[model samples]
Target: MNHRGVEFTVAKTAIPGIWQWQFRIGEETKTGKTETKIDLLAIRRVQLRIDRELKAIGQRTGPEPESGGMVAGENA
Candidate 1:
């Protein structure tokens, strides 16, 4: 699924414990052929980037992380 400039691909496999969510960044190589890869780290980074983009669009919620669960830095 693609929204605005963000392209998100969510996939599920038959393997019960295996799952993959890939982020396709449109980049052309030297040959001018558009290629795609699974950018796991970029997907994770999107949380921060998306928040900024959202706020820029007048959707302000302070600088809170886009998660509903306890983050690693929060006190348990």
Candidate 2:
């Protein structure tokens, strides 16, 4: 599964109703499990975690732009 240039995988686990997801970036790998079995939600969660990690290391791509052409934290 490719999302925003990042490749990831969301697979169902042996346990019913449980899903596992994994994604790798460079030499870093992230993994998690969700009970919802919704791939999109799991992917979003993973993306958020990655973003948080990147922000902690000061490697984020800055705030995302909001609607009306305004970026987050920007004063109109």
Candidate 3:
């Protein structure tokens, strides 16, 4: 289930200062029909997990790749 091209949002939870990020990627079924729903809590958890994993990988790999400097005569 790729979430690309879908709409999503990030919001703060009602409890104090907790944060929650939500994503809606529609849905799918074996019969070719889908019923989309908003599982805000679940989406938030998924985002947190992904963030943790990415951070771990970045730490192990020593920062992400950077873009090279532009050429002297390059047009903008």
Candidate 4:
């Protein structure tokens, strides 16, 4: 399943009210769990996490340029 360019999978666990969500991006895989079975909620949770990971790896998802931009700690 693809949501806003992010591909993920949601499956039921052995325990009730617990669902596992897994996202696959390139060679990396991210997984998480939620108490609700709503796919939208699960997708949102995964999206936020993926965004954070992307930003950490210097790959931001937006119109902002990757290079020639002011960094967070640089003195202007």
Model 4 whole-model lDDT (C-alpha atoms): 0.75
Clash totals, every prediction:
0, 0, 0, 0
TM-score of each: 0.29, 0.57, 0.35, 0.56
lDDT of each: 0.45, 0.74, 0.47, 0.75
RMSD of each: 14.4, 7.6, 12.7, 5.7
Best by lDDT: 4
Per-residue CA lDDT of model 1 for 1-76, tens digit only, reads 5545656554444544333444433451111111134445434444445445545655543565677788788898
* Model 3: lowest-lDDT 10 consecutive positions: 28-37
Candidate 4: tens digits of C-alpha lDDT, residues 1-76: 7765767787778987677888876688888888866757766777777777766656544565579878899999
TM-score of 2: 0.57
Better of 1 and 4 by lDDT: 4
TM-score-based ranking, best first? 2, 4, 3, 1
3 or 4: which has the higher lDDT? 4
TM-score of 3: 0.35
Q: Give the deviation of candidate 3 from the true structure as CA RMSD.
A: 12.7
